[model samples]
Target: MDYQLDKSCVYVQDPGPYSEGILDCENIKVEQNTYFAEVSGDEKYLAVYDAYFRLLRDTNPNLSLVKTNESIHDTISIYSAGFDYTGTSKVTTKRAIQYGKEEQANVTLYCSRQEGRIKIYVNIPLEMRFADLGYRYNGSRISTAYVGGSVKAGLYKCSDGTFQTTDGRLSTSLNAAQVIRDGKTYTASAAYEREGTNDILRVKGFYRNEMFLFCTPADFLAQGDIFRMYELESQSEYLMHNGGDRGSQEDSLTAFRYSEPGVFGACHDGSYIVPVRGPLNRFEALTVRVMYYVPGKEAVYYIYAKYVAAPHEIEALCAIDISDTTTAEEKANTITLQTGQTARLEAPPSDSWQAFSKWEVRSGSDLVKLSSNSGTAVTVTALKAGTAQIQAETSYPYTYEDPLTHAERRNWTTDYKTYTLRITSAESGGSSAAPKKGTTLKKGSISYKVTKAKSAVEFAKAPGTAASVSVPDTVKINGITYKVTSIAANALKGNRKVTKVTIGKNVTSIGKNAFNGCKELSKVTLGTGVKKIAASAFQMCPKLKNITVKSTKLTSVGKNAFKGIHTAAKIKVPAKKLKAYKKLLKGKGQGKKVKIVK
Candidate 1:
């Protein structure tokens, strides 16, 4: 029978004398006397048919099928034709074809209507070309293009000859875009494009539905037509599992030395590993860009990973004490210090696991100066009359197992204590509640006048016969102790027998002519509280040569306070106040030959 097949329809021609007519190929069974013929078209198509030519299922309209009664056979010849390719290229298939031509290939199969329908898949060999490569992560399309620029491959053939998508899962040769774990799937979340290299694609997201971050170059080709698989992990996990493995170690070292800052190494499967370095003492968040080299492309690509480390727990105790006066209880929270006085702060661990870390001045830094911030103890010198807050920190290492994952994790805990420092001027005797000026009273040979009633005293007079007059800082009179604050005018003036004089710490000034005309006086020691020397306080003391002034608060020196003193005399002052003292004593003191030393 001579019949022309339409391009859009399939024609069945049965060889049986009684069955010489067109039949629906979908319902027909592969009986003992049927043969199939398919026509080629410019566009490719797929179709399925029953064992006989009775049931015809047209899947695509671009191709046509014709069954001719050319031979009598129990097997049906399924034809998939019209594959466009270059003539020089070769085509091969796993199943041998009963007949082959330049433009078509066919495979023979045996089936019947009782055995169910038969599916013929057209396997066409096409050139592999990557127009644009990108990925999908965390159920989101991170890149602009799907594998090979949207090749339309969501359908996969099952072993039963039926096409399915495996429950909506994407089926493609580029499996790097999707990750399946614990019965769930995750796709790439984001994409980063390197400048000037649009061909190189990078994607990042959680790997295997875990918190571990995964990033890598998305340009690669699998070995075969089947889907390619890859294993991804974090740098810490890689190190912990393969630290001693020779090949892995070599790769790690090479990557560590040559790769960019945070890049670890490329895994054997081509995915790059990043690190989550932890055991941190404080909360930290950071993003790191990793650079990797592609040997085949001779180019570099970049990927980014983010890390967040949580802080752990530590205990510390620190105390600040006025090194000389404050008691232990008073030192715990607050202490008072006079200008120029020092306090020792000690930070000891509350537990054996803790140790001291550092010390810092949280506020009022100008009020105090520290010897050193590190170590268990630091000496702080009161700089001025102000309040300061000093802080000390301590830390210890801690390890615990994660409850859910049962993984041992390590971290650090830190604790700090801040102590308040109340600083007062040394001239004020480091007290705010000092007594007010009151009536004068006699205490032994030296008469005392209350500068601050009951709390302070001044030297009113001294015995002229006393060779070495020592001014006490405080003297008890009528059962009350007081700070000796000053030397009254003419208190010991013209005392020839007084060859040496020592000023008390609380003394703020020397009255005018306090020791004038004392020819025998040679050496004098001034206290730290001394602020002023009245006019002619030590005038005409010809023998006065050794002078030690310890007061850094000196503000005034009266005219001729040291005039006519020994020409070879040397005046020593606080090192830091030397220049000011020199300028202050320029025209008021000993001869120009007198050397002022610190």
Candidate 2:
């Protein structure tokens, strides 16, 4: 027989006769499915070594033929990866042997297809653990041709341990992305890149994430052909053995894992491991180590809740929640914020706050920060300018100081919260409400008195409706040359109706819940003086995308202020001000890659 093989495909030539034993070999048997390499990160996913295994399979028919004898297990060892790289799309691992100050590996872990779980290949479990894994270098060649514009990945210190990565492209071979040590975060502009003859990439050999743990299996490569194991990490693996009784009903189908940790379950091979879903349990320890590096500083921010809670846990956010002022009490109490207190505004709820460090509130001249750990009350006394608004924002990879004092930094969310104070002076007993001038509201303390009216408030009854009752076709309040500060609070509370809002320049702030559930209203442009924004200020405004905050000196923005607002991904932040915007966006609940413009 003759044959030919190449990179893409293979071909065979003419062949002769075969041996007689070829057909008779059907009676031979093999042990249970072989062990394979396992990999788990982001979530504790499974890395089953389905290729390499040492097995003795020679079945004998003892009078009555019977199938028996089988066993398999995962290697004991977990890698700790605290360096959180944002642009990281894959993690690769290979085994190495030191020879003349150089470590070499004959095998590379690669990605394989399994029905449900991720599969990786390794050189049969010689030593399995995070420690066995080290750096491999092959000079850098522009990888952007394959990876989309040099996906920059920064190193993050684990939340509680030390995992260091040199930032940038270092090592003269590749740029370093990140590193962690002694529970502190560090980064360098250098690292190494591993190269291969054919550009074949592989996944890591030994690893564990918040979700799974994977190690290379013995049968990773059988006869040099790759064999994949799908559905490696499934709940069925943890199913209880019914004393040799019933088996699973659905054998082929796999279960989708819940992206979470701490939930205990069993394994088919009868084993249990805690899941780490977010950051790698990254680990590295060194004593009496000489080092030369600089410590970096992180931008500080505050995170907060932006919406109100429905009876149950459900997202109730639309436009600024101000229009929903059905009850003067909630309307009045809504925008009214107390300094030095963390307002438990609803909507995004605990998850929003959970992502960042503790947040602080600044009273008068509204602006909050995460660095202010002291209980010192926010100083907002000077805000007698144009109504003052207070809001806080926070961000994630929530860092823990103790337990080795490490951190897992990743920009997933920019939490925001705001307390609005609209001060344009409303005429008291005039069927309208505005901030109390010269003095704050103290119950019975009259607001603006009905002095003069340029137009009429009897024109439009609701939005989308042509004004049947005409006020001054252009209602100017307090002699201010501008449109009426359309009282749109709690406007369309539970109603998914209401579309289009004509904002008046003189209007300073939009009350909470104003257009909370208005799934229709899309365009919004607040007048220039609009200061502080309230939480849930725009929660479920699905179609409401266009938002213009003209406040030049605008200090703070509320949490979830613009969440779920249709095109948040297409957000237009002033380009010249993105740095300051990014600084302000450090709070949790913010998304990455959001488009910004000048």
Candidate 3:
């Protein structure tokens, strides 16, 4: 009997009394070389290897061997190779020495095609972890190509230290098509053809995104592959275990499995692949954990790989969002900022799971830099007419529970949010900071009248459905910044949409009935410069439950300043001035019925 084998297909021939030579369906000639030199020692391992490579060649016939090499380590040898350059398609291969090892021998392979397609092969217990990948690309385009391995991965947005589901999870069996996100349709993946019709895989549509792909043997897709995809928008992170317990089921919220780091590599007996698309500058670090188990001979191994992008393809981004109004989604909106003017940038509010830990200016010329940056807010000065990007890094603690085993796990993950700033020239017709005849601040459905008083500007009234208002420290008019000194009587009276207010630091007084009858008002933060609270300033604010005063300059609190306010309303003042504030409040017959805290 005789045998013939090649990269695409394998054939067996009978000599003399047994068989005849055979040609493959693809019309490719076969040679007498073992499919994979690493696992050819044992019939069992060879059979597995042959089957795997056959599937790969069949799935995409463009793959061809490029080169192969070996590395000797004391008692063990590591064999490595790469597929022949076929236009844009390239594959990287790795196999551990299996001569005397009783454990399941395996090979790991990674491949990339020009069209943004990634494929990988992982055999046995080897696993790879990508600590950090992808760079920031927003409001601009950056094209990159990678050759080596294929993988099916999900594109996620970094949110508050956890990865949120931007695009749904992807699978190995999926074809290039559109993916759905947040009820919106988006381009998931596309195929690119090179000059000579070479196919490359690329993620075509979407704004700022990073992908995670796991390469596995074709059989794993049908044999309950350990690689799992999850929609973790509501979760900070997930926990998974590799104990061979396939039927395990548990409430992700109640219990969590053992999770090592960011994400676990697909562990099996084949090739594992990862193809990264989107903004990626350098491979800060790639860690692989190889867990070998052979009954009485269990062992563990690790491998690290570092790769960087070509200088021309590298970019540093400042992740920032800008808005002209005040709302929950303020930081996510895009606004036209006036040249030579300044805009305030803020991170999302804190919650039980995550918070914006800090802000940084990743990259920008003099046209964009941090005027003042802190975790809560930053003041950005638009030096000229151009676009600037800022990044808000958040910290979040990941908690998971495995219901089946009632296992609990905790981890920390850092998240990055990209904010886009479009700086238009002050001469531009759409400048957001250009002085207007009537400087009205519109938020949501309602609009507030910002009128010029004798010495400064004041909020006159709430006329629309706007729900939140942020009084700026100064209003620019003809290039002059005018301080906002007061909230005129009836400023926001009877406005159902008004909910929260951030008084400007330049404010000095709240006239009588200033915010009276604002039934929906619940939270207010008074600036430190406030010197007096006129009579009935906040009277009839039935829903005003909290007042945070950052001022120590309070001179007087007019009678009934907060009378008829919500009974549960709590007054919070600076610790050092708490006693003085309380005394002033009581002396003016304004307190004795409210809660005060330092």
Error of 2 at 263 (Å): 39
lDDT of each: 0.48, 0.28, 0.42
Positional deviation of residue 302's Cα in model 1 after best superposition, in angstroms: 84
In model 2, which runs have C-alpha deviations exceeding 4 angstroms? Answer: 1-495, 567-569, 573-576, 585-593
lDDT of 2 at 405: 43
Worst 10 residues of 1 by lDDT: 313-322
In candidate 1, what are the lDDT values of residues 414-524, reduced to their tens digit?
877677777768786755643234344444455555667667777877766789999998887544688898998888987889999999899999998999999999999
Top candidate, metric lDDT: 1
* TM-score, model 1 to reference: 0.28
lDDT of 3 by residue, 352-375 (tens): 445546787665555676755666
- Candidate 1 positional error at 91, Å: 99
**Compared with the true structure, what per-residue lDDT tens digits does model 2 show for residues 1-598?**
0111222111111000011001100111111221133332211233222111110011111111111211222532322111111122222332332212234332223323334433333221222111111111111111111111111223334454332324432111112212221123233222111111111011111111101112122112111121111111111221212112111221111122221110122121122322111121111111111111121211110001111111111100000111111222223323322223222222222344445433334453443223343221132222222345445454544433444545554445655554444333233322334323111121111111111233222111232332211112243333332243333445444345555554544554555565566677666655555554555666677776666555444455556666666755444455565666556544413345444443
lDDT of 2: 0.28
Q: Identify the leading candidate in terms of TM-score.
A: 1
Indicate the residue-level lDDT of 163 in model 3. 23
Error of 1 at 131 (Å): 99
